[model samples]
Target chain A: MMKRGSGFALSIMLLSALTLSACSNGEGAADGGGKKQTINFVHWRGEDTETFNSIISKFEQENPSINVDMTVFSSGDPYNNGLQAMLLSGEGADVFVSTPGSLFSTLLKSNAFEDLSGTPLLNSFSPDLIKSGQSDGKQYAIPYQLVYNVPVYNKTMLDKLGIQPPKDWDGFLAMCQKLKDEGITPILYGYDVSPGQLINTLVMNLMPEDDSFNKFQTGEVKATDPWFAEALTRFKELVDKGYILKNASGTKYEGALSLFAQQKGAILASGSYSMATIAKQNPAIELGLLAPITTSGSDAKYEGVHTTTFMLAVNAKSKHKEAAVQFAEFLAKPDIAAEYANATGQLLTVKDVKYDSKELIIQSEWMSKKTVFQPRLINTNKKIETALNESLNMIVGGASVEKTISTTQAEIDRNLTK
Target chain B: MKTRNGTLWLFIIPGLILYSFFFIIPAVSSLLLSLTNWDGMTYQFDWVGLKHYGDLARDPVFGKALGNNVKFSLTVIIFQFGLSLFFAILVMKNTKLNVVYRTIFFFPTVVSSVSIGFIWMFVYDPNIGSLNLLLNSLGLESLARSWLGEPSLAIYSIAFVQFWGHTGQVMIIFIAGLQSIPKDLYEVANIEGASRWNAFRYVTWPLLAPSATIVLAYTTIQSFKSFDLIIAMTDGGPNYASEILSTFMYHQAFTYFSFGYATAAAVVLMLIIMVVTYFQFRLLKADRVVY
Candidate 1:
């Protein structure tokens, strides 16, 4: 009886082990006998699915021996959690996308990215734009896209109404009133997630010094400072004047984009990354860049905001490291970068890439003017960023500016202590 | 006799090993991880020894999230429990119409929570939403407001969805319990001239104790796990007013990369659920009930 029971137990244990091993076997390409090496590429830009596939096809045509399998996860928790889960399990992609700032810093600290500083493609990208993917003087990733971090207004509507983009805060207010007079929602503001976007455009011009926000991170500058207060007051002013729609705080990204695309609103308070998407939603809509000008035209130090994001990095643990690096180099080529830029209606960080898309050509005019890098990205701690954004949102929610500032300062102080 | 005992031990060993591998190991590891400052990225992390818990004790967001969780869970339990019990009693006859009603009610439970959240978000949208349009058309424009956007109403709004989705499921359980109660008890109550309410208060209430106990515990757990619905709807936004423990922990780990802090929050959640469930069993004492 004892032997019979022990034999049954042994069979169960073997079955369990077999099941566990089977579940773990299919992650990375461990089959060594395959003739072609396949490298997995993952990114969060589902919108760029077609453009990336086209690029991959060209890359595959050039490197016939190597195959690139691309996967696109939607932005936010799905992509972040999916990638992190893969990394935690030690089966991450060969080449992946990284956002600049906190996410890049976290991955860099964890040594998830390979050192790409030695790659010859480094010289092809603009030095200032490439610095976004660097940490402690070591280049780990290559930032590919240069996006204007300002509103994309309907150029056709603005021109039909004989309204040019505003030159200052007063002009901005006047434009809002004029648009409202015509039964248009002045700004399609989605207070849910775009509070940070709006705050970045406003505070970039409000900074007394270029590194003012960086100082805010190190506790050298308090959130209760006058400039921060002014930024909050400006947000509240937009709310008080009814420039944005009522119950705007409840509107999310899709609803806001839909309203603007349908021409229910005159201006979408979103970045240039959304320009292509807006055009797709309404092909007849002519788009233009509208950076919020806080000072008089001559006194304004910065005409717009820009950020170099969608940094590409090779996974450090990838077996096909050479192929991954080759893919990165291929993307950096000037002609190839221009192809991406024209196809996606995005600006490229590659030094000599040219734009042909009408929307891109018109918005590229802001590239000649002084544009500050998104100051909000200067602080790498997401907690602090969340606090600042919450303060701005609270101000719009009818909370007093002083109270919002106090709570923001307290959060800042607490985070700094950690 | 000795060989029989040894054979029994041999049979139990395999199941014990499997349980330890899956459940016991991860639970203990999470407990240990809560004491460190691990950021969920790298292998290298320093042992902070309760520093995360210390920070959470003073964190105002954590306090608000705890209060929101309690309010959310209680509202779901009270409303969901009452509604399910009422429907279960009404549908106890097991006719064809009643079975169709049961199936119709259970349909939402099978639907994905994320889908439900999206559908409800459109319904609650401030502008161009069906709810506001309905209210306006009915000449109740004053009652039209952003349901999911208001801080005071967001948690409860999501709670209403939670209960609405699962009440059908809970009602099925209660119906089974009602059917199992002996009809002779009701007959005796009628023969003794007891009112319907009195019969329920004495016979049905005590007899339904076992199912009620299970339903109460299940509802509590379900309400505490409202992470997906809350995330899909408000994402604990508009100044963290609707933030609950699960969403709060998720944001800390995934958003803030503070896995250690998040694990501490998880540990607290587990402890709360355990204690609450234990007290529920104690209060009901349904284990002692026998037909």
Candidate 2:
């Protein structure tokens, strides 16, 4: 009887240990004070690590009872996969950042983020900027940064070469020709995310509707449409003119940025978010924002493309939801947002935040100008987005516009659910 | 005896439970999940029942990726095996210089795949790459081209990297096999006035067949597992010219969020590996000799 009882006790002990191990979130441990808690935060913005750490330090100072532990993944698929695995297993994070569109949709479908619609944090952001993080009329995340998703040009180079920023399609072509004639590559392009950004900048003034990417999903519009084909043709023309680098499609993001910083190219076909990095690479580079004018007329609808991305959200399964919310609310505060904007060279969605960075100050004037949302991020289906992005790469690699459009349209057609 | 049995079970119980929960259960779940129209994150999904398999059959990118994998595996296996064996034989003698050479060759295998990928990407970079730069310096400027950017050359370029990275590691296996061959066999061949080629063909080659089998199977799997290197270098691009089955499945599952489709592709990959390995063992089993 004694032996049997001891065995039973051992079994119970083993089960208890297993349960204890499973219950721990690994990092979010509470100390003696019941109010004290740690919140795990994860994001993909490794470049903003220092700035975010400063912000978190400030938040922790104000709320001494809460500690924020942050984890950053290298941007792109690595972050997506890491976050998805964690959220699926209900471990590792309490607060996280998300991008708009397909990733946001995935997070929402998983019921991963707590709805921020009724929260006071929602009131602090611009309503127009907040809409990108919304789905089915529910605000699941708060977009923190407002960025012009267009090419950032070297103002110093253009000034020295006596070139003006083009306002129309023909002017843009002429500008490229002139840059090429002056023994300069007109554009520096990267292989990874530049193709999508280039296509987005090109189609912003040309796309018939603001939500045409979604319209493609519904079969209301198609990739084979004349607008998209024109975008491809224009992209191809730049390649044919030898204005794009001979090995543009082979260049990585950092390589292109470095080349552009060295004055190898007049324009870097990445967005305004890259301003800080470009400055870091070459502080002497005088930067200006240029959106490709696809239309010939001065009555072009949008001056550039803008997106409210780098969305922040409280994880739904967070044990310290109040602390997570508190930290988010701290970020929404005007002074803090202003500090973030100035330090990171980013424009924030927070109302009445002051900009101090020279680049931010210059680009801030374009905020009031007519700017469309990043059309690429409007699609809920990522497969369609990937196909469209690949279409741009295909055109860059010398594929015919007809084949590119048909292939993309077929992908869109097959992916349509509605 | 009873006490020994009880102790044995005590050791086995923990590992059995872990194996069941971690490997066996997840693998079975993955197999089942392949039948459903699951989007990975969403909880609710309908049973689709082999529809993903049918879709994969008709998918051109999947076909292209499979073809690339085949081409990649064949190229890596042939070149990696032949070169490793040749180097192994040359350095098989237990001399100080040979040891140094062996260590030098095996050094790359110890480095992480990501670092190797990054290093090779720089080497293959069209403008600033060492290859093109070297060609230009040698007055061969016309021969210099985008090594990774060209679709026709991308997969072969990646395959060469795989071969370069693993040849030394595989060479170690052949070296071990060479050392195991009885010195008397070579003496007998020499006494019979056997030519160098004839001795190697009869003695070293036959004795090395088992190691060759291991090298072949390992290189095959390593080629398939070149997902990280490919992702870092070309990301299965210029177009899908460099994509293999593993990268294709990763894009489908993680990038496109099509868990069901990706799982189906994974199942196909598993079956392919199993059948190929089976054939490898069978083909080699005939030549394997026991002392």
Candidate 1 lDDT over B114-147, as tens digits, reads 9999999899888878999999999999999878
Candidate 2: where are CA atoms >4 Å away? A1-32, B1-23
For model 2, residues B1-291, the per-residue Cα lDDT tens digits are 999999999999999999999988988988898999887776778899989999999888899999999999999999999999999988999999999999999998998777998998888888788999999999999988788877788899899888888899999999998999999999999999999999988888888889889988898878876798899888889778899999998988888788899999988998898889889988888877677
lDDT tens per residue, model 1, A111-156: 9999888678798898988888887788999888888889889989
RMSD of 1: 3.5
Worst 10 contiguous positions by lDDT, candidate 2 chain A: A25-34
lDDT per residue as tens, model 2, A1-418:
5699899999999999887775564433345444567788898888778988999999988887788889998777788888878787776778899889889888888899898778888889989888988888998899999988899999999999888898898999999999998898898888776887888888887788898877877888887788888888888888888878778767777778888988999999899998998888889989999988988766588888988988999999888888899998999999999988898899999999999888898779888888989999998788788888888778777778888888888777777754
The C-alpha RMSD of each candidate to the native structure, in angstroms, is 3.5, 3.5
Query: What pairs collide in candidate 2?
Result: none
